[model samples]
Target: MAAKPQLPPTTVFLLKTRSSPTDAYEDLFKAPNDAGSRYAPIFVPVLEHRFVDDGLAQIDSLLTRRQITNGRLQSSTGGKYGGMIFTSQRAVEAFKKVVDGRHASTRENATSSWPSLQDVPIYSVGPATTRALRAIKLEPPLQVSGEHTGNGEDLAHYIQEDYAGWKRPPPTATDGTASTDAERPGPKTDAQAAPLLPLLFVVGEQRRDIIPRVLMGDASESGPPHIGVDEIVVYGTGVMPSFAEDFERKLNETLGSAVRWVVVFSPTGCDSMLKALGLLDPETGRAKDLANRPRTDFIATIGPTTRAYLNDTFGFNPDVCADEPSPEGVMRGINHFMAAWTASQ
Candidate 1:
């Protein structure tokens, strides 16, 4: 019998900090999707984050004073904000510190440390951030939403609808006196009604304004009522000093196996990432000899935001841009691209 042709080994380098226990990407690619394929995944930490004490203290005050609430339920004593927003895992980590502090201080109490804010809606951008928020140890727990949206712009639109409906009065049951459904009607749309309280957005120093803009921007003639927003920067991000060295070391280690894909999670580390890959030129700061580069070695972005950043800043177009910012979304895009490439070859 003749021997079958051997295929090149495939490896994927994820340029982001890995989540504890298990990262979604690591879990997704742990096993090959194909019987004939082999994939080795490596994580390269790109950014380091630190919590800001001032911002955390402000959140602690708000929770301590019973300031954040759903105005409809606690109208008399509710604070100025109705809910909270989270867009990144780092911000959630910072928020968790405040939560842990409160829990420690009130360990002797019979009730949850977070009493007034338990029922308030807590909006999250995607599954990763939602997971971080969900992991917080609260007594009654958090009411997290927008995990399905997968990005900021989509999550913002979802929040507008959900937050509006949340503020509306609950339905009333009919007494024996009334015979019609209108007599015991549900909450009605109140165009002229007072707007809901602002949402306290806890975010990193570097973040897009899409959420706040969409939720708090001017309401269109036909759109939902404009919700107010307040932002508190609870964390700051910076490229890890050893990113280039670490990334290059990983790439060299995987030299025996063809590094098939480099996934960029954020725009913060693109320059260093590309430089470490030996694809970026030293002077012009652009991709070098694209026509001669390995066709099988590709770059992928988490979503359109990073794609846009690479295109606009470096004039480099990534091979794949995941439609959604999730592990499944990235996998789908890569699979589709590989299928099309194979056909072309």
Candidate 2:
């Protein structure tokens, strides 16, 4: 009888479709030589991105020169501009459209008579978001966390320490610990040059409560956030209806019970998976109630926000999380996960 070829070492479930690298694993597992033993784990995407376009029109309204009057910074409501929070690259791209307006096709349109927000400290969350801010020509001292992956609570600490201008700020560490209450950030009045204006959070409709919880504190009401955020919905997350239909058929046809590794790149993707898998309630959309997920599955998340979601929502600790929220970081995390997994097996 003829000899049969052995299959690859493992199979992985990649919980991304749109932004996930096409050749991620191919590079990781491509055979060095034609005769060398080949080991490449198969990757199947479990989620897809559907960009919402509702709040896009609102950006044009916020970026008007009228928003900036008397050579002084003002809010969309004509109040003092506290500052802006750039948590995602999507928010950065959306803000650019607002400032760039219809003149985006023209290079001269990049610079408008409206004063630059260079004076206001821009607090960015992700490294990609930081790069996006720079791409829009916003200059530094753009305050960012030293670590690439972090939760909104981490962002809150950075704000309290760096933006709030405390006397002795906490160390820029990624361990997810807070400083003593006695060392809490001092308050900044609205009149000072470095005043702490009411922050205008340029966020999506499905945004998490972590930022509001940390910045604005607890609120007694709904509809309007209790936190100090002058919130604006620059975008919303729509769904790719095809992902559910395709994910199941493909998963069954290819992966079956062999599923070992799963990766979550965003909280939205995580929620979508939970809901789709019947582990979450679609009606309530709350994380308090939970259901059992696959015990054999180990999830690797891309950022701390997603990691926090996994912990807070279902009390499930991720197997591994990316140190850098990039394609390379994803590969590194996967390799580390496989190494440990192999050792255990």
- Give model 1's clash tally: 0
Candidate with top TM-score is 1
Instruction: In angstroms, give how far residue 181 of model 2 lies from its true place.
Output: 30
Q: lDDT at 254 for candidate 2?
A: 52
lDDT (Cα, 0-100) at 199 in candidate 2: 67
Query: For residues 1-345, what per-residue lDDT tens digits would candidate 2 score against the true structure?
Result: 978876554445566543222344355445343323334444445533233455666545444433412111221224344467778766776777765654554447545444345445567875556766666643323333423535566776667555444232222222333224333567522322222346667887767777777777753434223325666777666555665665556456555444355667676556656555455545666543333433444567887778898788766567788886665576667677666765766
Which TM-score value belongs to model 2?
Answer: 0.58
TM-score, one value per model: 0.87, 0.58
Question: Which parts of model 2 have CA positions greater than 4 angstroms off?
Answer: 1-12, 20-54, 66-79, 105-115, 137-149, 164-195, 217-228, 249-260, 266-298, 303-333
Candidate 1 — which pairs collide? none
Give the clashing residue pairs of candidate 2, or none: 82-197, 216-227, 216-228
Error of 2 at 202 (Å): 0.7
| lDDT (Cα, tens digit) per residue for candidate 1, span 1-345 | 999987754688889988976798998877667534455678999999988889999999988888887663223434678899998988888888888888888888865546455678999988999998888877578989989988788889999889877743332223312123323457543322445778899989898899888887888869777888889989899999999899888877777764478989999889988787777789999877787445647899999889999988887899899988898888888878877777776
